[model samples]
Target: MSVRYAIYFAPAKDTPWWDFGAHWLGRDEHDNTALPQPLLDEVSPTELASITQAPQRYGFHATLKAPFRLAAGTDEPGLITGLRTLAQTLKPVALGPMRVATLGNFVALIPHTASADLQALADACVTGLDHFRAPLLAADLQRRRIEQLDERETELLSLYGYPYVLERFRLHLSLSGPVDEAVAQGVTQAVSAHIDRLNTEAPLLLDRLCLFVERNPGTPFQRIIDLRLQA
Candidate 1:
């Protein structure tokens, strides 16, 4: 019923991960670009397809603000302006060196150290733009598995519309969806190898804010804008 939008931190276009992940997931979120999967050694396209299918729709990125409907009176243009204003005030930092790690059944790239700057940025994104977010529907609450959450988490979910935030938020660039331990291990090795080859020394400044929109239900989110953070 309501249009959904999310605030996400995606790799910048020139970053190796940007195009590398795009081809791996076979979807370019910026322009909804699609490409055939590359020939991965020891990993077949079919296997890669199955493991990545879940995260593929969203493309490759970390969720800063989980998707939500715009608050009743809010409009897209206003939200965009509000986001730009917020970005301007937040300090930027590079992601630094990251390595592949397995969180549950998914493989992702996590920074060697938790950067306070990154945490502050994520916290601001969640709390700052919250007023523009419509309350979650009952079904949405159920989907979050509220019964399994602790008291504090339930409260955050009620106030913030998502449980993973504040203390719970883990900033990781996901590379695969759910898979068995063996498969996850394999994916982790594969991702690590790719990152190792990249050998990026400089950290990506976490200044740019991207607005991703779900134009319709069951549709892939597209990057509508890259709002720069100006001093």
Candidate 2:
């Protein structure tokens, strides 16, 4: 029974980011209902749909703890307790302002400036619950292509079980996967409008953390638990 779970920042239900992300990616987090994708003239429906297929499964979130199986002897209740304990000690982080940014082949929202609190939150999630993380299997290592990692990244992978963390972590709500570089700017422009809509209301805050579960390989990750920061 191989299962994977992640600690993540999932926007509150009914918030602009949540609604827009769910509909844009065509997967509603609340009920896993299939929704319509954003209609954009710059990117044809076919192309947009194809690019979003990857992100849609995971729904909309910024990874705090990348997905991993529970370590031997650890149980679900223990993981939840660990998450709640961490949540109580942190404060909600205000995302000053964000814009569509390119990360490798994908496009997503990135903050104008990084927040120290956010960094601490992510680092805590990576390290605090680390004891609950099972060691990465050979197949998992191959999926990340450990051979291509730089020395420091390889070290991070070995130490933290994920390559992008600490100084390398960039909080992003992924919108697509492996898009064409030629149309990247246009794609960003298209999504920028949606992000603009998010600005019309209160600035988005990282007020709550969510637990996402993948019951098995190829299954859609579902947002199963939400914990509010006591502060």
Candidate 3:
């Protein structure tokens, strides 16, 4: 089986952010537990489950380096060593209060204000760890739907094996997959209400880089370890 790993910013366990996301997604990446999702008035539990299927599989987190297979000459131990070295030079980023927002066709938690520090951290994860990522296979490239992306995105995809990085990256903790236009608004509102109920008003902090692993295709990604930023 081909394993894949990804670098991501996931709020620590025991925190409000972590609890809310885990419950909302109906899975806890930290423990690999299936959680009971919040019940919404307008959306039935079955329908909510259907809509959240995609993000639930990936777990609740914001992608930093994206997922990739280990490159030639690089192993999991080497990747961890590299991340530990990188973590020493990085500092935690404070992303101001977040709100549920629609990005294209999906809903996600997005920061109210942009943070250069967050962008820098994501850029570092993508470029600094490029040596650990194998070149994208033809099947992988096809899966990304290259034809849907613009010129710059195509170039980034070719260079980094994933587009939506560096210049094009937008920090988002996805809540659902592609939502139908008819139900998008309701889903967003429901998520926002759920967040409000949690009352997690403090600014979101990007304090650690979580190493998430998928043992094989079609399997849920799970958190393996969290490397803190010492700087």
lDDT for 96 in candidate 2 is 51
Report, for every candidate in turn, its global Cα lDDT versus the true structure: 0.82, 0.86, 0.88
lDDT of 3 at 63: 95
Question: Candidate 2 on 1-231: residue-level lDDT in tens?
Answer: 489998889888877788888887988865778898877888888988888899988989999889898999998899999999999988899885778889988888888889899899889889888999999998889988899999989998988889999877889999888877867787887878767767666588899889999988988998889999886
True-structure lDDT of candidate 2? 0.86
Q: How many clashing residue pairs appear in each of the predictions shown?
A: 0, 0, 0
Worst 10 residues of 3 by lDDT: 194-203
TM-score of 2: 0.96
Please, what are the lDDT tens digits per residue for candidate 3 over residues 71-178? 988899999999999998899998756788888898888888878888889899999999999999888889999999999999999999899999999999998899
lDDT accuracy of residue 130 in candidate 2:
97
**Candidate 2: residue 145 Cα off by (Å):** 1.5
Top-scoring candidate (lDDT): 3
* Candidate 2: 10-residue stretch with minimal lDDT: 193-202
Superposition TM-score, candidate 1 onto the true structure: 0.94
